[model samples]
Target: MGRIIAIANQKGGVGKTTTAVNLSAALAARGKKTLLVDMDPQGNTTSGLGLEKNELDKTTYEVITGEEKIQNCIVKDLFDNLSLLPANRNLAGAEIELMTVDKMQFIMKHNLEKVKKQYDFIIIDCPPALGMLTVNAMTAANTVIVPIQCEFYALDGLTQLIYTIELIQKSLNPDLTIEGVVFTMYDARTNLSLQVVENVKSYLNQNIYKTIIPRNVRLAEAPSHGLPINLYDPRSSGAESYDLLAEEVIENGGEN
Candidate 1:
């Protein structure tokens, strides 16, 4: 069975989507069968993989709602090894639509169960909120990869996220583990960045990732062109940092 992972953070502008897009792309480049699910209604992950909204027949919103199977929803990305269940503005309304449903927590997990073995990793790019969608992501995921930006208030949202995770673990999925916390947009020159890093480390302890994402213009610009940094500018610093992150992620999972 494939490992289902959710790239999540309650805080926005913390490079959550950026980490999800590049990490999935880098994993595919390394010959892993990867699937990126754009659970975020913003659809940045969909477009970042060079997909057009009109090109998708169905989306992750439909899949989660049991309207379509994942096999029917997935589209090929720039890398043949990587596929996507694209999302769009319509996804934003799913939370309200699903509100009346019982067992909403397991909707995503149950939807993915049928196609669990189709890939090595299933990466869900969750919406940046603690809403029903994010709750479903937690229930469906075997683990979560949190992206924390280096800043003073970063830790504020993390406490809420952790509390939410604990509640989910106690009530829903007991096997749901914290995959790791990745620090993003790190500037080595700033004392603030270093202090924030140290603070995150002190808080999460061994759960934090050693590989940090540097603030690179190339990374920030890739999404606008609808390409991952790995494909847009493979030689750029953004690509190198994400490559290292991929290796670290795989190693953490005991995969080479």
Candidate 2:
């Protein structure tokens, strides 16, 4: 069985999609058969991987709605050893559609079952909300990787997220666990960033990752070019950070 890890955070602009894209690429670069699932309606992960979101005919919406099979919806060769289940604005209606369906939270998990054995890791890029879509992702995942922006408001809403996770653990996925919390957009020069890191480490302790992702122009530019940091600028600090983060993820045994 492959590890299904949801890269999730309820807040936007926390490097969630960036982590999903780059981390998947890094894992594939290491020869792992990785699948990147764009669970977000915005389709950033799809577009970030050089796919034209608007040009896609089949996407995650169809898979979640049972209109298409998981294998038929997959876009392969986006990167070597990487496959993508793309998404687009069409997914915006899925939330409403799923509300009327039975066993709604289990839809994603059930769909993933058909293709779970083909990959070493399935990295799901969840939407920035604690809604049904995120719940489905959580219900499907073995664990979750939370990316927190290094700022004063960094810890806000985390308690609620954790509470929701516990609820899901009890009711949805009994084996669910938190992979780790990674600090993103870190700036060494800013005392506030350092303070935030110390604060999170003090509070979460072992739940936080030692690798901190620095804010870099290269990282921000990669998505525009439809590339991960490693492919965009392998020598950059942004690429280096994600590479180190990937090593930590692998060392921790990938959601085990």
lDDT of 1 by residue, 1-256 (tens): 6788899998889999999999999988888888888899888899877778646659988787778887788886547688888998888889998898988888888877877787888889999999999999889998899999998887887888888999999999998889998999989889999999988888774478888899999899999898889999999989998899888888888242
lDDT of 2 at 172: 92
Of the candidates shown, which would achieve the greatest lDDT relative to the real structure? Answer: 2
- Top-TM-score candidate index: 2
Writing each residue's lDDT as its tens digit, candidate 2 over 1-256 gives 6799999889999999999999999888888899999999999998988889988989999999888999999998678998999999999899999999999999999999999999989999999999999999999999999999999999998888888988999999999999899999999999999999988888774478888999999999999999998999999999998888888998887843
Clashing pairs in 1: none
lDDT (CA) for every model shown?
A: 0.86, 0.92
Which portions of model 1 miss their true places by more than 4 Å?
54-57, 254-256
Report how far residue 235 has shifted in candidate 1, in Å.
Answer: 1.3
Q: What is candidate 2's TM-score against the reference?
A: 0.98
Clashes of each: 0, 0
Q: With candidate 2 superimposed using the best TM-score fit, by how many Å does residue 166's alpha carbon deviate from the native?
A: 0.5
